[model samples]
Target: MTSDISHVRSLTLDEALHENPVGWFQYRLLLMCGLAFMADALEVSLLSFLATCAGADWGLSTAQEASITSVVFGGIICGTMFWGVFADKYGRKMAYLAASTLITVGGILSGASPSYGWLIFFRSVAGFGIGGASVPFDLLAEFLPTSHRGQFLIYIEYFWTIGSMFVAGLAWATLSQQGWRFLA
Candidate 1:
C-alpha cells in the first residue's frame, strides 16, 4: 500500500500581514502618517503662540483669549467624535483628506481673520481637523506588519515633537518682527 501526502499551506490576513517584512509601502505609509501627527501637533500648539500675538495686535481681553482656546478644544471634541464614526463608515483615507483640508482652510482663514470672533471660529475649524489625529494611526497600524509595529508607532510620535519644535522655531523667526497673521 502507498500513501499520498499534501504540503500546501494557506495564511489568513492576520497571519500574512504579521509575518511579512516591512517594505517600501510601509515606509511611505509611516511617513505620511507621521506627517499627520506633525500637522496635528503644529495646529494644537500654534494657538498658544498665536493667541499672544493676536491679543497684542487686536487688543483682545482675557475673556476673549479664553473663549478662543476653549472653542478650539470644543471643536476638537466634536470633530473627534464625528470623524471617528465617519472614518468607520466611509474610510480612513477620506476622513484623513477631509481633516487635512479643514486644517489648511482653518489656518488660512484664521490668519485672515478681521476680528476676535472670526479668529475663534477659524481656530475651532483647525481644532476639528486636529481631532481627526487618530485616523492616521488607525490606518497605519492596519498596514504595519506586527514585527515592527510597536517601534514604528513610537517613531511616528517623534514627528509630533518635531512639529512642536518647528512651530517654536517659526514663531521665533516671524513673531517678533511680523504680526501673528503671517505666522499662521
Candidate 2:
C-alpha cells in the first residue's frame, strides 16, 4: 500500500511538470497576450492618424472631427466595464481571443469607412475590444510569480509602445503619398 501511494505521488508530480514544461507554457501564454496588446496599441495609433486624414478628405470641421474622437473614447469607457465583467466570468484566453477578433474586424471596417460617421462607429467597436483586452493584463500579472510578474507586465507596456510607434511610422509613410485610403 505504501509503495503504491509513493508511485502515484511520483506520477502526479511528473504530470504536473510535463504540463508546465520548464516554464515554456507560461512564456507561450505571455507571447500571445503581448501580441494582443500590440494589436490594441496599433489600432489606437492608426485611428489617430486616420482621423486627421478623414477630417481633411471628408471636409469635416474641427468640431466634427473632435466629436468623432470623443465618441470612440466614450465607447471605450463603456466597453471597459462590459469586458471587465465578462473577463471575470469567462476565462482569460477566451476573453483575449474575442477582444482581438473584435479589434481586427473593427480596424478593417474603420479603414474602409466612407464617411466620418462610419469611421467613428468602427473606432468605437474597436474601443470595445481594447477595453475588454485591458482586463487581461491584470489577470496575466496575477498568474506570474512575484519575482517575474512586474518585469513581464512592464514588457507588455513596452511592447504596446513599440506597436504604437510602428503604426505611427507606417501612417507617416503611407499617408504622406497615397493618403488614408492606403491604410485600408
Identify the runs in model 1 with alpha carbons over 4 angstroms from their true place: 1-10
lDDT agreement with native, every candidate = 0.87, 0.76
lDDT of 1 by residue, 1-184 (tens): 9655556568876688887788999899999989988988888888788877788788888888777778889989999998899999999999988998898899889999988888988999999988899998888888877777788889899999999999999998988887788877
Per-candidate clashes come to 0, 0
Candidate 2 lDDT for residue 181: 65
Error of 1 at 37 (Å): 1.0
Clashing pairs in 2: none
Highest TM-score: which candidate?
1
Structural similarity to truth (TM-score) of each candidate: 0.92, 0.83
Clashing pairs in 1: none
Query: TM-score of model 1 relative to the true fold?
Result: 0.92
Q: Write the per-residue lDDT of candidate 2 for residues 62-174, one digit (tens) a residue.
A: 88877766766776788889887787799766778888888888888987897777888888888888777576586666566556667778878877898899988888777
